[model samples]
Target: MVTLQLRQLTVPPGHRVILHNINWQEFEAILTELGDHRATRLAYSQGTLEMRMPLPKHEVAKVIIGDLVKILLEELEIDSESFGSTTFKREDMNFGVEPDDSFYIQNHAQMIGKERIDLKVDPPPDLVIEVDVTSKTQLDAYEALQVPELWRYEAGKLQINVFQDDKYVESDISPNFPNLPIIEAIPTFVEQSRTIGRSAALRAFRNWVRDTKNI
Candidate 1:
């Protein structure tokens, strides 16, 4: 027989505690316990446990938004780091959730550590991307982290939300990259990706840029 020990995690107000210190067997057991609940999902770290609930479908629009951001990053001259399906944890609530894609700009992008990020002090990603495939759990995760900027992509459109004045507000432009034409370029990228290979897409983008510049 295998046994698992549970430890309470101290989190700040408005955050929930995550249980820590369990083996794989224990982790599986917990999920089994919560089977078919549809209200919560459990995430396990090396020695930690994080519990989160589902969010509404509209809340996961960041996935498509992230794909758009990645393509833009490759085209622009800026130095940045982008991640797909990466996990971030907030110490205040012991909450751990994975973003569809997350990014950091310029020097801030280099600050990421090699192993695990210590979310207690490190600033959250400049942007969080989520795709509403099925559940609302993504929204619950973001709310717990109190991250600043989140872009959700759903129903074939993108919505940009920024955390300002202690709340989230929709914006016409992204706070992270004000120069990029997000709305104008996103749909084009999405449409192109569906019909052509990646190299072809790049060539088309180059042509579009040259034509727009009258070069």
Candidate 2:
């Protein structure tokens, strides 16, 4: 039998590798080995584990969307704590995922001084953002964790999914920000970032959010 160490494997950019039948202990060991400094993204469900290396465009989009969300919260005077791609997992449920970005809006106070997320005791993020520049998103982990809301950006569009009755259903409105047209407006700003520069696009988005208050 041929054996390969996790370190021996290299997932190229814009690609993903899947390991099937990975037991819980093995998953923990692999995560420990990978450490917190890596660039690869991960999602584990049941006995399957997936590792993906995001494209450069994917990196830009997720960060801009995260910035937009924070802008929205600030403009509205809504307190929030953003955790960019912090790994979230539950051993009892056998599910784990690292989102593109996450935020604790309603539960920000509870997470004020927390060093790390322990899903068994801590609440799942109020909102999770995923930018699918390459692979399709695996929703099982988010559902298993009962994340209240999700925003998925794909093919230059944003789709909001709300957790309902133990499952995810597409929703036009984000419970966190129901007043704005997130679906139509977010993609525009994200696209603008490519042409006008990130800072300019973010500034435009911030201005737009502030303008919404006047109406």
Candidate 3:
């Protein structure tokens, strides 16, 4: 019989290390041990686990994107709850993933005033934001968990993906915020934030959204 060993290695920041043949029990233990360490990201599917430490550039983009999402939600008067880097997992599906940022938009009511979220009973987040500066997204794990929406930012562009029939398909617009030009507008604002500073760029974005909505 071949038994897989739990191996550990040290890698540079933003590098991903794969742990092979790890079972659910061991994976849960590892997650518990890594608690509250916000810089690291973990993804697991079947028997494969991936761990990454995001670089500074990656984190900057992640924050800007998340901030923009919240700004849009607020300007639209849409209720939302942001969960930054929260680990979402499902035991029965043998999958687990942590998004750069996640939000409950349409499903915000269900999460109101709750201290802990259990996917087993509670509804999954309506939107998840992923910033892919170097690594590709682990879509298989998200698919297993049935997350409804995804926004992926890579190479200065944002792509919207909607989950349907157990798969994710690229979409030009978000179903929840259909009128907002999310794909085009977000990346543009991200660039503005980098050049003019986050606060100024955010104020401009809010003004733009208000004008656009009113027109």
Instruction: Compare the candidates by lDDT and give the number of the best one.
Output: 2
Candidate 2 lDDT, tens digit per residue, 89-203? 9999999999999999999999998889999999999999999989988898999999999999999989999999999999988999999989888999999999999999999
The global Cα lDDT (0 to 1) of model 1 is: 0.58
What C-alpha lDDT values do all the predictions have? 0.58, 0.93, 0.87
Give the poorly placed runs of model 3, Cα more than 4 Å off.
Answer: 1-9
Off by over 4 Å in 2: none
C-alpha positional error of residue 118 in candidate 1 after TM-score superposition, expressed in Å: 1.0
Choose the strongest candidate by TM-score: 2
| Residue-by-residue lDDT tens digits, candidate 3, 113-157 | 877778999888899989997688998878888889999999999
RMSD to truth, every model: 9.1, 0.8, 2.4
Q: Is candidate 1 or candidate 2 better by TM-score?
A: 2
Candidate 3 matches the true fold with a TM-score of 0.94
Worst 10 residues of 2 by lDDT: 206-215
Q: Please give the lDDT score at residue 40 for candidate 3.
A: 76
After TM-score superposition, the amount by which residue 111's alpha carbon in candidate 1 deviates from its true location, in angstroms, is 2.1
**Candidate 2 clash pair list:** none
